[model samples]
Target: MHALPDIVGYLAAIIGTICWIPQTIKAWTTKETKDLSIWANILVLLTITLWFIYGILIGSIPLILGNLISICAVGAIVIAIFRFRSQ
Candidate 1:
């Protein structure tokens, strides 16, 4: 019943969250973010943060967990962009 949907939600969340891994890896290993847009990443992070807040309010584990991980992944990308850009 409800459990099935939540399971599906978690699966989707995992898939979505992992999508950032390659980019994060590339950004860190190459230290190259010239092609990555800071504004876009910032906006995405902001959106994910909002989703996380909403998830908290609604008590949705999937949204909360997914967005939390997303925030970290994207946050890392933002940091990478800045760290590499200044150099």
Candidate 2:
């Protein structure tokens, strides 16, 4: 039988995932990446990437799913920074 998502785990995932929204919105609004640090984004993206791998390894859906969403959001910010900065 498939185990349901733990309530606390679900809440944790939601909180972490939602926390990324403000950064995303800020990037979207400004369309300027100069205010953000490339090193910080790279570090965060790397950390999230590892967390995602760990989540998968542990077979924790909440962890895996949450990190995946975070990667996308943060990834977009990283890409936007590089893309806009390049021009």
Candidate 3:
């Protein structure tokens, strides 16, 4: 049904957005990203980038916001990982 897709999208966006909070909090508090894999993060970032673009193309606020937040969270982790790794 058409309604099912909307419901699923909303739920997915909420869960995906909230799921990122822990990683963001941990990175902010610990300022350590040594445990995160560069390749993994890169892949995730790229995926998010594509999702964000898709969201914009379709004018989906949930997708846009969710992926935008994910980008920030993943980007922070990547920065921390590199910073801590160097030190």
- Per-prediction TM-score, please? 0.83, 0.80, 0.80
What tens-digit string does per-residue lDDT give for candidate 1 at 1-87?
A: 699999998788789978888899899999999899999999999999999999999999978988998999899999999999976
Q: Pull out the clashing pairs in model 2.
A: none
Error of 2 at 28 (Å): 2.5
How many backbone clashes can be found in candidate 1? 0
lDDT of 2 by residue, 2-60 (tens): 34667676677689887877888888778888878999999999999999999999998
For each candidate, C-alpha RMSD in Å?
2.5, 4.2, 2.1
TM-score leader = 1
Worst 10 residues of 3 by lDDT: 78-87
Residue 22: error of model 3 in Å?
0.8
Question: Model 2 residue 67 lDDT?
Answer: 91
TM-score of 1: 0.83
Model 3: colliding residue pairs: none
Candidates 1 and 2, the one with greater TM-score: 1
